[model samples]
Target: MARRKGNNRKKTFGARDDRNNGEWTEIKKDNEKWETYYKAQKFIPEKDWDFFKKTCQTQLPLTFRITGNRKHANEILDIFKTKHLPQLGNVEFEGEIIKPPVNLPWYPDNLAWQLDVSKTVIRKNEQFSKTQRFLVLETSAGNISRQEAVSMIPPLLLDVEPHHKVLDTCAAPGSKTAQLIESLHSTSDEPTGFVIANDADARRSHMLVHQLKRLNSPNLLVVNHDAQFFPRIQIENNGKKSFVLFDRILCDVPCSGDGTMRKNINVWKDWNTQGGLGLHTVQYNILTRGLKLLKKGGRLVYSTCSLNPVENEAVVAQALRQWGDKIKLVDCSDRLPGLIREKGVSDWLVYDRNMDLKTKENRGDIKESCFPPTKEEAENFHLDRCIRVYQHFQNTGGFFIAVFEKNGETQKDAVVDEPPKEEPNSAIVKKMKTDSGDVVVTKKEKLPRDANEEPFIFIPSVHPELEKCWKFYGVDDKFDKNNCLVRNATGDPTRVVYTVSKSLKNIIESNEDRMKFIYAGVKLFVAQRSDIECPWRVQSESIPIMKHHMNSARVVECTEDALKVLLTHAFPTFDDFKDESLVSKLKELKTGCIFVSIKRNDPLKEDLFLPVWNGSKCANLMVAKDDTHELLYRIFGIETTRNEQKKPQQQDEKKEEGKMTENKI
Candidate 1:
């Protein structure tokens, strides 16, 4: 191959194929940008020619175009032509030409989504036909292959059918988010459930959205906000509709990413002890914030790609100290048994003097602690609940996971939180007679499933070919059946029945217009009152009780049978409603239902987030004229404006500089 010159983009070239001997050479004209070659040769590969051609072109063109000038490009081409053409055949560059592998790793044994084309030219290969088909296969413990990870999801997810609200904090390039979505959809069908995926950085947020879009999951919502400030997004789970308190939250916080060192050599360069420590505060804040977002008895899983103590154990310890009994550490050894589990207590690295003393006494080893002895030793000790996934297990990169359970009554019977305050027209009257002959109002526990023990019928539409799969279960409807209970006309629109409790029956009849439920049966109905203005909410304390009790009872069709059983049960505490209302008010305040108007001046003005009152003097935060102040107030609702504050000395200097005559006048 010889180098040609001129305007590469404007050059008009045509291929000259050889019928007998395949070879290709550039066709050049004197006036054109490129040089011409005589008698180009065609290259042939040992493998199937069609497959080889497709493989070369599918993921190569983007990297090849605009590589460099004609000479440089030809030089690169000559290398590939001489090296690969003889065996692979002269692959055409006209339509989607695949670039030749350059100086890259040739590790064919390791299976990945990409091919080992070159050191820097990693690419997605199109050779495998089962690229998108999901399958399930069992492998040795902790030795699951990539193909297995990709295929084993559907069945397990169907079994896990996670219906509760889930949050993926630090989600970017959302691989796990996609998995979560798939699991949610495959699980028992439930209407009105949602997943919130959030990321802090603006650029990565776009990537998160992009990855999620490919999954086509209707349940996911992407949010762009700092995890530390997520509490500001008020969620209402009013009795009528529950606001989202995450049932499951994944805090995959940012860390030093030591596990990624093989791909990102940059991580190993200039890595320091302080680098991991620097992220400790942010990681801790994110986990704590996630804890707040959890409903009572909700589960949270915190993971990191770093192996350092400051970034892992230290952060978890900080959370445990602050939350204490409110959050309990959950062992996840069963989920990842193949990977070695560094006993959380044994492997936990304590940096502070107080904690190090305990670790040393317990382990009788000083050198192994991540925080060995240093001037900062006193600062790093108190952490206890962090686990490390080491490279010692299954040749995989380091990963740390900690599952926390938010249980017990506000940390106290450890009873649940109160329910929302009743609306003026709510049927939950101040007082009502219980079946036990007490005039105690407010339902305590959840009502029974239905009026009778008839199994609740659900019809789900299946693919025509899969119709046989539904016959055994007696599925009458398809997607048309209500997967979730709703309070609507007749209360059994979806054919699901509900059973009302003795105390609740009066409330239900009192506000029949506002009452709603999923009558899975006569004695049981998923009851909710819709008259409330806010979203439905559930208190943290009530979550455990709800999960435990709900898990035991099976759904029934008749409402009467459910009521018979529910009437015998005591209502939940009066506090559940009180807690619900308190949380509802908090949500209202957070969602900005009450608007705060601000003034703005320059159109380009940034940092206008302050919420201030109308006509009030703005906070003296900026330097501007009355017009600017008014504009600030109008634009941001900040209480203070530039007009209310004196100009700073730096502004005075700039003003003086502006006044100086350009020409010596």
Candidate 2:
């Protein structure tokens, strides 16, 4: 399991600390240069400077967002709000008062929440054990996310709809990318749009896949590519091809990350004025590229985890100047009503690495764009629309966000390629070209060397294997059969069959020769070995996507109490349920995998859908052990699964591998 991030927040990278005589030593959070630089810019009031620095030095609170498939997330939230929140009243931990987690008012539907408590206390204290178990179980089940409170803002503000094509410019360790996907599936189980999560690092692209795959979103595609030179994609429409422009784009570019000082100790030690100044050009490049990829009237949000004006406002100023009146900053002063944030500074002083003010006369290596905007330029651009979140405000990490919308067409679009391409040998790509522009392909860049994903080949929709499964499950014409896909060269359903969204299917089919698509699709079917009518079984992860497409008569309803019995035992007989109706339904059906919708008597009154392996006389819950434990504890106040799949060599030992990575939320 991923480590539970402490109350304050978590970072993916950290330096090893030194220990003296087994005692931990804390690093000094004081930085003279950091204080001097911010004081010069005066982003906050002078009276609040001391408080801001103090807040940065202190530890952050534990924050998390309830997430997952929409129906499942709502069910978890209902259990938390109605069952857990009211029990922990007037609790005190150590010298401080530990309050129940409260909802972030700016967040929609009370989905985001935070509380002041450390991770150690949560693990060891009896007062928090109930809530801790709930968090751990749901987080493991891919329902709850322990992300920072402020980290959830940009995706929410992007306001993704079910039909908008979205792009996450630098998505890795994909917390925000998951949020955008949940929004896409919010209105309907089958959404029309898709998300392209692009990260430059090949290994980090795999990280993106790991984080997002659990959501089972067929609309999301993770790719390894430089954000500065992201590939151009064209969709075949009306027997012709056109470049696919995004409806919403997010540019959460890399920055100095000084805004995360409260949670990251290294930020306080390594921060310098040059940190932001050096990153200004790249930040500007990414945001501009994102804008170019956006459709006219589309919205793009540019943001960073830094407070430096050079990194925040300076980057926004340059993009505004280059785009002219074609794009403008969105006025969000009234948005996020409960959020406490300051307006973007219209003007600021620029300093060099040596702490000398860089004026036009003595500006040595300082880029002209790094300097403050002229008086008239500021008025025309309305830089004040940008948001500046301070550390002291609401006791959260500092952040800066600027929303922009494209208003008109541009004269030209940039298409970056090298020279020419060699003949295609692999399924990666032959050459990247669209209707709007020609692609530049070099000899060495013929195929993606890092991606090892098998080719996505479509099988015959009316094949014998599919016909058996569809008929057995009562799958009708509501779901498209042509979208059935297999990841082999022969266009055959060998082991697992997949399904992708219509939008994603088009991209993969059109650009399979050149695009580096790492992973996409939900596991629609898996080859099964049982004496059942169907040769393939529906995957548990795909139940939410398939619930509406399958017949209601095929679904088996069970009481919540009976669900606990199946989760705790390995293979319980039908008579173990002690319910005549449930036993009759099990006897009447063919023995194979089937969907079991549990009828709950909780405040939410939502039916929980799960997959079960039904045999001639016995049945078992088809979920992982972590998942089984979650249902047991959440519903029946029981923890621990009675049946664990045994690994003979290490039967006594628990699961532990050295490959654990930290959460970077």
Candidate 3:
């Protein structure tokens, strides 16, 4: 299981030690850096430090095993240490190392200390797989945050068979995706299943990619598009399209993120009544969409990180309202006995009959629950189906989840794809033709060979407002081409086709200018833009573009010289011209290369230094070079036996290979 340290009011588990303590040591090697951070407050006196130090030693790797019968607790603990402990030398209890079990049955034939427990965890004597174990310890910023939402997923889902198709809607910064991969052992086994992780915002899908790389999960296909409008894609591989309907889907929708209060005080500080309401609609939309793709008897889990009633119960209640008896809310309260011990409030504002707190809270600042209901009455409604796990319960982060099954027939009509809209060639033509005055152009001659020779168009520099629109729309396709093609529509040259091309060129150059931005920092959203004139404008046509482009646009790091080669050779496939006419045009134009600038001091990177109350670390580090690796080892208190530092060029390559690449940083 991921380990935990002690807690302090000032030192919330997720608090950044480096940010909180500025004199924090900064150790830089290659492209990566390392620094120490401390959470937990200074509440303990000097004398208590001795005791706390002892606790830290013993509690460092504490795995909280909640047993069905208290009598088995001691026996289980004894067996764990005696039989299993010796073989798993890397595993620890608190901080001290123990020997392998001398007195146990069914010992390792080839055991690897994996922690794959049965679904009935509390009831049996569980064995730890060679893989690491995990627990839902507590909910607070110091322990976990919104970005790590998927970490709360039960490892039991990993029990899924090979070849199964899994869907993770609202999957970004995919911690759960990583977990599923680890369980499936994607690297060694040729599993039959594939994981389709989708999010509404195209940009945020970058998180899933980053985590996938770090977690080294290859069975996943990342899609940067709206999950609600997911294409019913057919995968005809070896002999057939292995999957049509998904066996499992996780709808971890967006919410106010109340569970993140411990890490992000800003949310709680700015909390408003409408906070939950604003996100509930989108959450409902994504969930309903997933339900459509589920096969008969398929299981789906709807979950959220927010504690607010509007986001949690209200959305689920609305879902039940919309589907009638087509779906049944299965009881998942029994899944985590460690978590269920905590009480959850079922008398949410939605159930209030007379003094409806929801209405009162929104209409005005109402203090009391106008429509009060008895505890027994609330219990009868199975409000308990909505699990409310808090941080205090297990020193883990807070999160809520409910499982359901599709019981009856799905929509009889072949699930129809959203109708296609007509293409608007006029708009596309106008945008390329309009003249953009005073547009910034790069004068760097003999530019990096890998850089695109195509006349660059930087969108942000050409028009600040257009750049603002980029964030809203995400990619180049989202622009209103109809407006672009109608040169006279805007009268302004800068808003025309010529200007649009210039804008595109400028964006390419700027990306080159900001070389550091080559890698995505954090994905905030995902979106797509379509051609106005393509005949294949159906959902199928759109899916390929979104999938291929999403994969292609991703930044891959190589040696500086190699990157320069790739950048200088970039070109554009301007849709303005047909392929017959475009053949000669391609030879004359050059490929485009843009530099992405990353902040010198990125907040997300800084956030990693925050103390992890209960955290997991991969032993074989992905570092840039031997020196950088040495530096990290030193911080972790590992002694270095050699002193040979590699050359800068070699170090750079190693750094590219070995460092921890964050989703946002």
Q: What is the C-alpha lDDT of each candidate?
A: 0.38, 0.78, 0.39
Off by over 4 Å in 3: 1-150, 154-159, 186-188, 236-243, 340-346, 350-381, 412-665
| Most lDDT-accurate candidate | 2
Ranking by lDDT: 2, 3, 1
Model 3 agreement with the true structure over 1-665: per-residue lDDT tens digits? 11233445354432445444444432211110000000121223455544433332221122222221122223333334554465555434445443332221111111112232233331232233321221221111111112232244533432444556677777777766544544444223334465666666655766566656433233455554566666554434445433257778888887777566544444434545456556767777777877788877778878887656666665666566567678877776555333333333454443221323354446444322222234554544455565665444333345767676888755551175742422322211223221355543223221232232222222223443333333322345533222121112233323222222222222222333221111111111111112111111111111212222222221122222221222221111222123433224333322211111122132322111100000011111112233232222322223222343322232333244232222101
> What does candidate 1's lDDT look like per residue over 477-529, in tens digits?
43222222224322222322222222223233332222122121121111122
**Sliding window of 10 residues with minimal summed lDDT for model 3:** 30-39
Evaluation by lDDT, superior candidate among 2 and 3: 2
Query: Who is ahead in TM-score, 1 or 3?
Result: 3
Candidates arranged by TM-score, highest first: 2, 3, 1
Which stretch of 10 consecutive residues in model 1 shows the poorest summed lDDT? 32-41
Cα misplacement distance, residue 658 of candidate 1 (Å): 64
Query: Any runs in candidate 2 off by more than 4 Å, and if so which?
Result: 1-24, 68-74, 414-423, 426-446, 488-491, 530-532, 599-603, 637-665
Candidate 2's residue-wise lDDT over 1-665, tens digit each?
A: 12333545643333223223434445678889888888988776799888888898898998888875555678788888877788766677776667677888988778888877777777666757768877877888888888887888889789999999999999988988998998998887788999999998878988888889888888888877678766777689779987788999999999999989988888877888889889888888888888888888899999999988888888899988888989989998878779988889878988898888888667899998988789999999898999888888887998999999999865374344522433566332223333434443222222444446576666556666787778789897888877778877455677889988878877877765566777888889988763457767888768878887888455888887678677766666676787789889888887677778886666554578888776666666778777877877667766553344312222112122111101000
